[model samples]
Target: MGRHSLPDAYAAQDSGDAPPRRRRTVAIATMLVLAVAAGTAAAAQSGLLTFSEPCDDSAVRLTMAASPDIAPAARAVADQARENEVKSDGHCLYVEVVARDSYKVADSLARGDKDPDYEVWLPDSDLWLDRAKGNGDGVPVAPGDSVASSPVALATVPSASRTLGWPGKTYSWAELVATVMRSDEVRLGAADPSRSATGLLALASIGASSDRQGGDSDTRVAEAAKVLAQRMSDGDAHVLETLALDSSGAEAGNPRRNHAVLLSEQAAFAHNADSAGSGKLDLFYPKDGTPLLNYPYALINEPELTTTESRAALRFMTLLRNEDSRRVLAQRGFRTADGTAGTSVIASAGGRKPQPYDASAAAPPSPAALQETLGMWTITVQSARLTTVVDASGSMATLVPGRGQSRMDVTKASLIQALTQFTPNDEIGLWEFATTLDGAKDYRELMPTRRLGDPAKNGGSHREELAAAFAALQPVPNGATGLYDTTLAAYEESLATYVKGKFNALVILTDGSNQDPRSISRSGLIARLEELADPERPVPIIAIAVGPDADREEVAAMAEVTGGGGYQVSDPAEIQAVILQAIMTAGQGGQAAAE
Candidate 1:
């Protein structure tokens, strides 16, 4: 998990600035050829690089959108490449292992806007590969070891073993899954396929395993996704990732955030079987062993490169897989990629050996049977309402690295990008919180409103207003950090008072730590939010913490209470986009529940 901390300021400090123009010197024709080229190439006479594969030998710029979760491993690979442990052409191997969410990775590849110097892209799952192929440019290759893997079995803490079925018998993969689903307490946990690799793979596994009635497996998968989403639509709900369903709730921060992403056997080790713990996490392996996702390593051949840069990247990736690195990973509750490393509890208890993991053995569900008999399905569940909340506090004056722009400037640019995702039927409102109008008290008010009249009808032109607001935003610094207070205010005063009938939401963006506990205590916040929402009629609130020590737990609680989730960004530049997406997604979920 990414440490929820904001970075320091940089060169510029302008609050509202237009998005910086990205200058790519590559010829358009060259990019087209690269897009259309195969993933192999014959021997190169220049001897710069040669591939027996059919990919074109031209400078293929492969951009693997590395999730923050797996950056350590990706950087480790880069380190190995630098030390010659893993070899590749520096000139042609342009790998941009970015910290982009899975959806963004798919979008960039699908649109052909992403030019990777490397041909291979290792996402969390192979679903995006299918979508990419549908767009004509199939995934070129899947390489590298599993970055993270865990047993997808029934898991209970050592403390709860007596209560839960810890030493349960080895049921078949289908039987175990079916059995789990049978229990009200045994809900499945996985990331949403649209946004997460684990989610997509899990959906694909369900589709590939089961038989579809009238619709294709894709349709079935979509339906199952909806069921999973519904189960997770409430604050108290927890989907089993790897831990037991009971292991997650509003009280357990990490578990609650990762309620839906458990590991499959394929990720555990070099081989596969069904051991005791492994049985709990039965593998719903694809018919073709789940199309492998290629994880590529690129050695930057940039003119600005330094010896340290190369060393750092290579050392980091190698470290990720090294025994020490594995230990670090396990300490953070992440599964070790190397099977031999086994499992270790996040916090050791009196020097006891950490939990043991048998990566070699797994209980894979019958691929053919799964293909023949699909169980549940999922859907996009997109249609909903969204509200964007901005923090114009004094701290917003800080700057972010790389872009040499202020946090506020980058926020505006990112918000503008987010505006592009809304539909007319999606009602949107904005609010800002700080000290006071005349420096007396903390307050929040509706800045603007955009009525997305009807999805069945034409959408209004509120995107421009949202974008303008983002651009016009200034650092309205003042008395206190009223994020929680103002959020409550929005739910009570704004949404309840003005936006009466429609679904309501708040995407609160803040860079500073929580200063007003009275406004947002864990218990009080959840209780207050509960009062605003009915069990059947739920609303969502997404909180984004941008600065160091931004009180992620409090924000997460707010999200959890409102049937949504929380996101923390270390980089201020990513705040606008991330927060907006959170708002939009929460709104969508809220609208679905209301309906």
Candidate 2:
């Protein structure tokens, strides 16, 4: 943690910059009461800093949800506060920021179930303040410096995208949005509104755009939700929480696989900078509007509060605003309050620059316009049909050196780990392929997309049962390859049986090329696949190749043809990574433009 100087809300309040006098009077009363008691007043006036509440010596706990855009800033602030506290002979403030998705956090606040002792609350949008208003005992959140005056905007990867840019200067919002809607390749990413500020902003932007065209924001939000629902079905997008950027990227919360994501500008900037050498991501700013993620420092005010913690919070605030801390924030791709850096950092950090952040601008969609837009909003998410096609062929028996394990063993282990990623709402089934299916048959009879909790369900179980199944997996003896037949069987079974489900996807993990003599030729297979997909209702097929023997070209073709993707992984360690990516990307609403 690096210590830096930040503006104090107390000071701002004292300087008459706070809300109305009535609110200021309440704040003053609260401060006086907090400073009154014997030991408390002595500690406050004496400048002795210590926590009023019990905190582990190793950690300064905080409750913050969905502030990826400000993590670096928050970190620097915490570090600098600890250092400043030490100089004043105070205990170290071990900052523990609880990262949740914007939607969950907002809901927690709405339900009044979130922790209330936090010294700071960094929200992705002020919408949360409205949600949290009547639920907490804290001072009213009637708009502050932390809330953005204008809504944030949507963004895209600049290199591959042809839309975006200002109207007249480039293309109008109508033209840009129309372009995106028509192209399957022009995939878009936004945070889940329920979990991320960026997601909320994206929703607001959609509403605003629709309203501009004579629709309602709420309806637009719902309509955009439908687009998301479809994308999720198609394996093109993932709805992960805000802070999963580094740990999981776009695959954080997705039950299926996805490659693109929606994050706060700050998070995106930080991620791009962290991946500067990789050059794999780009940012696109929707000209309409985006969620304004505003970070505000808060403190618990119950009678249990202590003077030490309050001072510590103030000290932390100072560190977050210090010049060095500001620099750290700039390095992570955000503009600081002190005007310390340029907005170009988004691109410099490896992502494309988005629309400028105008601190004083109005919220997206004027209040009067929001209603019309709400009517046009769209949101739809349905139960999906998912299948896991595993290769149990003898070739999987080969051992990889560095992993110190056979490829088959590793693949099974990875599959087991990936299973934990699924939620109860997801429909799952499994199939093992080799020269023959179980019971000496060419294709085994495994359950298809059954509910996870039923007794008859082999697909759903506690970790113990899942682990047992994984441990028992092994290639069958004296079997010839029937890869093609098995794939066809799985796909046909899902399409025929799970027709009622809104989305269907087949995940195939293979270590070699198609070897079944009965399997159709590559071109022939492509045509048949097209005919089966029924352009009106496409089913995505994600293929993961395991080793050098895997057919990269065939795998890519399968994904491209089926509106999904084929990812190659020579090492077992890459299985989890590749599978997660494919599920998120392919499961989302729109597919990549035919490439």
Query: Top model by lDDT, which number?
Result: 2
Among all candidates shown, the one with the greatest TM-score: 2
Writing each residue's lDDT as its tens digit, candidate 1 over 170-278 gives 3333333444455544445554444644444444445444432223333334444445664342211123323432243343334333222334333332111222332
Each model's RMSD to truth, in Å? 23.7, 18.9
Q: Which ten residues in a row have the lowest lDDT in candidate 1?
A: 3-12
lDDT of 2 by residue, 298-352 (tens): 4433234454454455544445544565566666666543222364764553333
Each prediction's whole-model lDDT (CA)? 0.45, 0.51
- Tell me the lDDT of model 1 at 239: 30
Per-candidate TM-scores read: 0.36, 0.47
